[model samples]
Target: MTRPPAKAPAKTLAPVVLIDLAVLLLAGGGLAWLVLRAQATLPYHWDWSVLPQFLAYTAEDGSWRAGRILTGVAATVRLSLWAGALALVIGTCAGLMRVSQRLFWRLCGGAYVLFVRNTPPLVLIFLFSYFLSGQLISTLGLDAAVAGLPEAQRPLAEALFGPLRQMPGFLTAILTLALIEGAYMAEIVRAGVQSVEQGQWDAAYALGFSRRQTLIRVVLPQAFRRMLPPLTGQFVSTVKDSAIVSVISIPELTFQAQELVSATYRSFEVWTLVLVLYLALNLPCSLAARWLELRLQRSDRGA
Candidate 1:
């Protein structure tokens, strides 16, 4: 027999559609009210037209180049990539340790997560950047070593990290972000690892795989597949968290926005543009994470 028309889905969405429209109308009205209030009571001038010019422009030689805002966007992207990579490594190791048989490993992982998650990030950044960073960098001579590099090689280092003189402070910023983000990531990893059934571990052991081999060859592969959604979401957090690093003079997007505001006094315009820029970077990652989660749900049902 032929199937009936699928009107039930539309019927189900009728209230949802109405609710969504209601929400949009309310938001629009609120924004309109704010604009009216700003015009009447506030000294702020809305000059959105001038904002786009800051994003990109032609250089003196007529070649296309990133402007102040775009340069900051690039810096933010670079910071997120480096910090996210390190956080993933730190988190994965800590996560594995959390599930380890040894008390020492477990304690170490717990302490890292507890300390990082509980402490205020600003305080931690100050300590790490001003005090600990100097001591550590001095011990390693990382900044001094980079500063002394020949002029020809300096640009490459700058491209990878930042200016040679600032690399030490920048490194500390990267480390602070990584260590803070890693605490949250560690929980994600721990949950992913724990989600794997005990039976899988037993099966691997019964097959004569060593503990390391069992985790690496069997459990982690399965756990990692499950972890993909949260991992993507965590990277979005990393992108947003990169903003605060600007306080340490990393010149990321927020820093650039602040500088533009200082120069132009276009406070609302600059901040609104920055908000949109951040959403542009984050929204895709959020959507992709949702898609991955949905796909995983479908696969589980099929299995």
Candidate 2:
């Protein structure tokens, strides 16, 4: 038998989309006009001469890729990666604890969530920097070992220390971002785990699976799929939050931007460049997360 003919796709246009585009264009034009007018009225013009110099090298500050900019970017990326990893570990444990039968585990998880949620992130950073971190560093003695490395290993030493030498400056920044992010991630994880049908747990138990086996084989895999989108979002947030470390002089992007602005006295240019740099780092990740989310959703629907 011959197959039936396929129907043609209907042609349609949404008026709302056109209206939105027109409004956006009008607003953009207005903003551009305002900026031009403001620039013309300025008492001093920006020296375009420094633009080429900035684009080339910042030799005066002894940095070829502009003073501290690459260092700041590296530091930000390092801190973000480290903090995200730490947050995942912490959040998973806390999430598991929140759902546990043990009172102590539940209480510990609850306390962490409440404390982190109630505290402002900046204050948390400060607390870690000045108070908790000293105790932690003393307890760990990690700094002493770092400082005790031999002269032969000084290159290795400096390479490691270049990003995080401060007693608690780097540690505090990492911990602060991790702690704050972990609270949100804990909730995401808890919800993902709980979203798995109770029937799965019962079936695993009926099959004589141990608690660990059941969690590892059945619950966690499903939970992880559900958790990926939120986790991706949290990762992006962590990158942005690394900027807050500048307040404590951890030498991340925002701090370096401030240094540039102070030295060049070009606040607008410095800030705009910093904004673009952050967007460059973050926008692609956000896009990837959205794409992954859509892909997972489609798979879920098909399943």
Runs in model 1 deviating more than 4 A are 1-15, 58-65, 148-155, 295-303
Q: For candidate 1, lDDT tens digit of each residue in 157-217?
A: 8898866677787788888899989998999999998999999999999999999999999
* Tens-place lDDT digits, model 2, residues 215-302: 8899998898889888988889999988988888888888987887789898777676677878898889889988887888899899
TM-score list, all predictions:
0.86, 0.83
* Candidate closest to the true structure, highest lDDT: 1
RMSD (CA, Å), each prediction = 3.7, 3.8
Per-candidate clash tally: 0, 0
Q: Report the alpha-carbon TM-score of model 2 versus the true structure.
A: 0.83
* Residue 229, candidate 2: C-alpha displacement in angstroms: 2.0
lDDT of 2 at 266: 82
